[model samples]
Target: MADALPWQQALWQQLASRRQHAHAYLLHGPAGIGKRQLAERLMALLLCQRPTATGACGQCKACQLLAARTHPDHFILEPEEVDKAIRVDQVRELVGFVTQTAQLGGRKVVLLEPAEAMNLNAANALLKSLEEPSGETVLLLVSHQPSRLLPTIKSRCQQQACPLPTRAQSLEWLAGQLPEMAAGEREESLALSAGSPLSALKLHEQGVLAMREQVVEGIKKLHKQQSSPSQLAEGWNGVPLLLLFDWFCDWAHIILRCQMAGEEVDLGAADMHKVLQYLARKSTPSQLLSLQDWLLAHRQKVLGKANLNRVLLLEALLVQWAGLGGKA
Candidate 1:
C-alpha cells in the first residue's frame, strides 16, 4: 500500500486516539487528490483484526481481501452510470449492507465514493443510516463538493477537508516515483499536472502531456489576442471544457497573486497578463469573486449534462471577463 498523504495521516492519528469515533465521516476535497485511496486505507484500519492506529498491517487477512477487492464486509456505493446521480435504491442497498452482520465478525466498512453525486432522494434515504448507524459499521462518504450535499447529511457526518499538495513537494515526490523521465520532462509534467502528482505521472505515462501543452499554448494565444476563442476552440473537440476552465483558473490565480503583490509578473508560459491586467483595472474584488462564481456555475452546468456550445461559451466568458476591466 502507498504511504498515506499528510491529511490522511492526520485523520488516522485522530481515529487512533479517539475513544468514540464518529459513525459517519465526510471526506471532502478536490477529485484525484487520493480521497478514494485514503478511504480504502481507513477501511483497512477499521476491518483489521490486529490493527494499529496508524494503518493496517498489510499481511493481515482483511487487508489481503481488501487488496483483492473481495472483502465481504466492505461495500462501495457509487453512481450507477457516468454523469448519473446515485439513486435512492443505491442508498437503500447500503442501508441493508450496514444492518447486516459482518461476515468476518469484525467491522463493516461502507464507502460512498463521490457522495455528492447522490440525488435528493438518495441523500435523504442515506440520512437515516447516518443518524443511527450500526455499532460496528463505519460509513465513509467522499465528496469533491460538500456544498452539493444535503445540509442534514453534512451535519450528521464528521467533515475532513483535503487540499492539494504544494508544487515543490508534489514534484519532488513524482521525481522519486518516476525516474525514467528527464529533468525537463519532469518539470513540464509537474506544471501540466497543476500540483496533482498522480495526474502528472498519469499524463506523462499516457504521452498526453504534449497534447495538453498544445491546448494550453493555444489558449495562451487566444488570451494574447493573436487568435480568436472560436479559432482555438475548434481544435479541441474531444478535450473537456473543464480542462480549459482549470487552465484559466490556474492562470487567473497567478495573475491575482501578482496583482495583489504588485510584483514583476512572469506569466510563465501563459500569455494572459494583458487581459488579466485589463480586468483587474476595471473590476473590484467583489466583481472578481462574482466572476469566479460564474465560472464555477458554468462548470457545474456542463457537468450536469447541460447542452452548451463550447466555442460560444468560451467566447461569452471572455466577453464577461473583458467587461470586468470596463468596470474597474
Candidate 2:
C-alpha cells in the first residue's frame, strides 16, 4: 500500500495512536483528497500481525497477503460499475462477510468508498451490520459528500473530516508532480480542480488545459453567433458531460457573484473573468439565478449517472445560455 499523503500526517498519527479502534469510521471529505488512502492505511494497521507505532509491518504474513490482494478478511464494497449505485445484494454480501470469522484469525476490515452511492435499500441493508458489528470487524466508510448520506448511516459511524491542503502546500506539491508545466499553468490547474492537488494532477493528465481552451474559444464563438448551440454541443463531443456542466455551473455562479458584488470578485482563477463580467452586466439577476438553478439540478443528475441524451442535454443548456443576454 502507498504511504499516507503529506497533508494527512497529523490525521494519521491521531488515528494510528488510538488504543481502541472504532467499530466503524466515516471518513468524510471533499473529493480528490486522500481519505481513501487514510482508510487503507488504517485497514492495513488493523489487520497487521505485527504493527509498528507508525503503521503495518510490510514483511508480516498478514501484510504480505494484503499486498497481494489475497487478504481474506479485507472486504472492499463499492459499485461494481463506476458512478453507479451500490445495490442491496452487494451490501447483503458484505453483511454475510461481516458475520464470518476472520480466515487469518485477525481483524476483518471493510473499505466502502463513496458511501453515499448506497441507495436507501442498500444503506438499510448495511445499517444492520453497522448496528451489530461482528467480532473484530472494522468498517471504513469514505464519502466525498457526507450530506448526501442517510442520517442513520452517518449516525452509526465515528465521523472523521479530512480537510483540503493549504494553497502553499498544494502549489509546492504540484511543483514536484508537474515539474515540466509552467508555474502559471499549474496554478490554473489547481484552481480548476477547486484546490485539490490530486485532482489537479489528474485534470492535467487528462489534458484539461487544452480542453478548457477549446471550450472557452467555443463559448466565445457561441456569443458571437458564429456557432450555434447544436454546433458547439457537437464540438464539445470530446469533453465529459459532467465536466461541461461543472464549468457552466461555475460560470453562472461567478456571474451572479459579480452582479451582487457590483464589481469583479477575484475568487482565484480568472479564465473567464471578462466573459462572466459581460454576462453579469447583460443578464438580469433573475436570469443568472434561474440559469444557476438549472445547472445545479442537471449537475446532480449527471453525478447520479442518469440516463441522458448527451446531445439533447447540451443543446438545451446552450439554448438557455444563448438566451441569457441579447448578444455578447
Candidate 3:
C-alpha cells in the first residue's frame, strides 16, 4: 500500500496508534485531502494478521491478499456508476456481508466512500448494520460532505476530521507533484483546488488550467458583446458543468465582495482581478446577490447530477452574467 501523504502523517499516527479501534469510523473532510487513503490505511491495519507499530506489515498474508484485491473479508461499497447514488440494494448486499464470518479468521472491513451518495433508502439500510454491527466488522465511512449524512449515521460512528494542508504545504507538495509546471501555474492550480494538493494535482492532470484560460477569455468576450451566450456556451462544451458552475459561483462572490469591501478585499484569481473589479463597479449589490443565488441553486443541481440541457443552462447563466453590467 502507498504511504500516507505528507500532511496525513500526524493524523495517521493518531489513528494507527490506537489500541482500541471503533466499530465504525466516519472520516469526514473536504474532497482530495487524503481521507480515503487514511481510511484504507486503517482498514489494512485492522485486517492485517501482523500489524506493525505504525501500520500494516506488507509481507503478511492478509496484507498480500488485500494488495491483490482478493481479500474475502474486505468490502468496498460505492455507486456502481460514476456520480450515481448508492442504491438500497447495494446497502442490503453490504448488510449481508456484515453478517458473514470473516473467512480469514481476522476482522471484516468495509470501505464505503462518499457516504452522502447513499440515498434515503440506502442510508436507512446501512443504518441497520451500524446500529447492530456483527462479528469483528469495521466500517470506514468516507464523506466529503458530512452535513448531507443522516444524524443517526453521524451519531453512531467515531467522526474523524481530515484537515486541508496549509497553503505553504499545499504549494510545496504541488511543486513536487507538478515539477514540469511553473511556480505560478502550480500556485494557480492550488488556488483553484482550495488548497487541496491532491485536488490541485488532479485539476492539473485534467487540463483545467487551459480550460480556465479559455473560460476567462470567453467571459471577457461576452462582456465586450463580441461573443454571445450561445457561442460561449458552445465554446465551453469541453469544460465540466460542475467546474463551470463553481467558477461562476466564485466570481459572483468575488464581485459582491469587491463591491462591499472596496479594493482592500482580495479579488481571488489574478486572471479575473480586473474583470471582477469592473463588474463590481458596474453591477448593483442586488444584481450580484440575485445572480449569486441563481448560480448557487444551479450549482447544486449540477452537483446532484440533474438531467439538465447543458447548452441552455450555460446560456441562461451567461445571459444573467451579461446583464450584471447593465447600463455600464
Worst lDDT run of 10 residues, candidate 1, spans: 319-328
- By the lDDT metric, which is better: model 1 or model 2? 2
Per-residue lDDT of 44-100 in model 3, one digit per residue for the tens? 999999898889998899999999999999999988997788999999999999999
Residue pairs in candidate 1 whose N, alpha carbon or C atoms collide under 3 angstroms: 282-327, 282-328, 283-328
Task: Encode model 2's per-residue lDDT on 1-328: one tens digit a residue.
Answer: 7666889998898888888999999999888777888888999999999988999988999999999999999999999997788999999999999999999998999999989898889999999889889999999999998988999999999999996799899999899988999999999988888888888988899998999999998888888899998998888998878779988988888888888899887733366777787788889999888888899999898877688888999999998997876752
Clashes of each: 3, 0, 0
Off by over 4 Å in 3: none
The C-alpha lDDT values of all candidates are 0.74, 0.88, 0.88
Candidate 3 clash total?
A: 0
Q: How would you encode candidate 1's per-residue C-alpha lDDT over 215-245 as one tens digit per residue? A: 6566556546676656666776655577667
Better of 1 and 3 by lDDT: 3
- List the candidate 1 regions with Cα displacement exceeding 4 Å: 6-8, 17-20, 81-83, 192-194, 203-208, 220-231, 250-294, 303-328
Candidate 3: the clashing residue pairs are: none
Query: Any idea what lDDT model 3 has?
Result: 0.88
